[model samples]
Target: MLKIGEVARRTGVSVRALRYYEEQGLLTPDRTPSGQRRYPEETVEVVLLFQRFYAAGLSSRAIAALLPCVNKGHPSTPQRHMLRTERDRLAARVEEMADTLHRLDQLITDADRRAGAAA
Candidate 1:
């Protein structure tokens, strides 16, 4: 078992965030007699998964909705649909970023060409 601070350090998540995750039912740690939070080693993975979902632009409510299905190793139809929607959003963002990169590359090339012509 690990204390909350230890878990936070190991997982690189803040103590407040861990507490928030507990409040959201994303994690349930054991409590010591004095009410200190004690988490199992497995909690590290859970925290990491939570971070990944957050990085993927999932809200806590969305993560909460999918948690049960994820735990069961199969997503229900609605859960799958939700996941697909999020995936599509991510794909669109990627395309937008690619376009931005292409524009920046063109700008850089044009500037370099102009500088060469001036020299």
Candidate 2:
């Protein structure tokens, strides 16, 4: 078993973040007699996965719900439904971001044209 600090070093996550994961029920590290957290080698990969999920805008509760499906390698019906719902939400967010990018590009182009005219 690896110590908590080792897991944090390997995962590039802060020790506080690892503790928060435990508080959120996402990580469950074993405790030594002295009350220190000890993690398995696979925790590095799990923490990376958590990072990806967070980057994708998943809440801790959503991740907690999905963890079982991930561990089992096959989602049950409800889990599949949840996955689809989250996917659709992410797609919508992406579309909104694309629209914002397009607007920003237009503003930049218009500003460039105005500057050229002034020149």
Candidate 3:
């Protein structure tokens, strides 16, 4: 068992964020007699996984559903599907961003050349 602070230190997450995660039903920490929250060692990995998936645009509800599969020490087919779907969506978005960036770069280069020719 680890205290909330310990979990935060080990996981590089804020204690407040951990408490919020608990409130969101993402994590369940045991309360000590003195009211300090205790977490299992596995929680560090769980929280980090949550962070990565969330950054990848996974919703909290989706992550909540997926956590059970991970906690049980089993892979989830549904979560895998979701991840693949998310990957496709992100790839599409990245392609769009790349196109936009390419257009912007071309505009900047053209403007620079025009300015040099004028000079």
Name the TM-score of candidate 2.
0.87
Per-residue lDDT of model 3, residues 1-119, tens digit only: 99999999998999998998998899999988998899999899999998887887878887787777777756578877866687898899889999999999999999999999999
What's the lDDT for all of these models?
0.92, 0.94, 0.87
- Measured by TM-score, the strongest candidate is 1
Alpha-carbon shift of residue 40 in model 2 (angstroms): 2.1
Q: Where does candidate 2 stray beyond 4 Å? A: none
lDDT of 2: 0.94
Clashing pairs in 3: none
Positional deviation of residue 54's Cα in model 2 after best superposition, in angstroms: 2.0
Winner by lDDT: 2
Alpha-carbon RMSD to native, per candidate: 1.6, 1.7, 2.8
User: Across residues 48-109, which tens digit of lDDT does each residue of candidate 2 receive?
Assistant: 99999999999999999999987887998999999999999999999999999999999999
Q: Candidate 2 — which pairs collide?
A: none
At residue 28, what lDDT does model 1 achieve?
Answer: 84
TM-score of each: 0.88, 0.87, 0.71
What is the lDDT, from 0 to 100, of the residue 80 in candidate 2?
97
> Candidate 1 vs candidate 3: which has greater TM-score?
1
Tens digits of per-residue lDDT, candidate 1, 1-119, equal 99999999999999999999999988888998999999999889888998988998899999998887767869989999998998899999889999999999999999999999999
